[model samples]
Target: MEIRLAGIKEFSVADGPGIRTVIFTQGCKNRCKGCHNISTWDLNGGYIQEINSLISYIDSICPNKKVTISGGEPLIQYNELKYLLKVLYKKNIIYAYIQATI
Candidate 1:
């Protein structure tokens, strides 16, 4: 299965520990008062991203770094996040963080 994504940010230090890969999944139920990416709330707002391709992209990045799943609410697409975490866990990268609003 695939998830809709607003965008992906690579090598971000603010996301978590060390340089990180940040995946911004699309769609959100919460309309925050001061959301940075306020444009992403629409349920059908972003492009569909293949899970395999995203994993491959993450694989291509330097390991031993952090990975973050931010939103537009990552829990909105829990399956993909769960699957991605499984892959990251197997690779011994335990620093995957999630930034979402409920």
Candidate 2:
């Protein structure tokens, strides 16, 4: 499956405890006041990426690193996120959390 992403941070400490890789998914409905990632609001703006490639990049960095699936709103691609989580889980990758905006 493919994913739309605003960006990917291969290595991040601020995202979670221990080493972490953050996937910044694209698209969001809620445009809250003073949003830092205003560019992620557009559903068509970011580049399309394959899920496998993203996982490969994460794996190449380290084994079983903590991952945070953050976005303007990650559930925007609910099915894709579900698949991504499954794959990550199989590889012993813990999903640290979802950085949700309410």
Candidate 3:
């Protein structure tokens, strides 16, 4: 499975309750006025990445093995995100958050 991403933060404390690996998923419907990730608004703008690759990287370097599926809006790519979560769950990785609006 593949996902479009704005960026990935391998180690981030601010995104979740603990040190987490944040997946900045691309595409958002709501153009919130205060959105920090202006670049992520475009659904086609970010790079395409294999979900396996992201999981593998997180497994290797993220000490907590925790992931935060953040976004422009995560639900924009629901199928890919779902697969990513399934893979992460199989690995016993602790996924801290999955943000979506509607």
Reference-based lDDT, each prediction: 0.83, 0.86, 0.85
Return the top candidate by TM-score. Answer: 3
Model 2 regions more than 4 Å off? none
Best to worst by lDDT, what's the order? Answer: 2, 3, 1
Query: Which candidate number would show the highest lDDT if scored against the true structure?
Result: 2
lDDT of 3 by residue, 1-102 (tens): 789999988778788888888889999889988888889899889999988888888889878778898888998887998888888888898765987656
lDDT of 1 by residue, 46-75 (tens): 899888788778878855557888889889
Please estimate how well model 3 matches the true structure, expressed as its whole-model Cα lDDT: 0.85
Root-mean-square deviation of every model: 1.4, 1.4, 1.2
Q: Could you tell which candidate, 1 or 3, scores higher by TM-score?
A: 3
- Estimate the TM-score of every prediction: 0.89, 0.91, 0.92
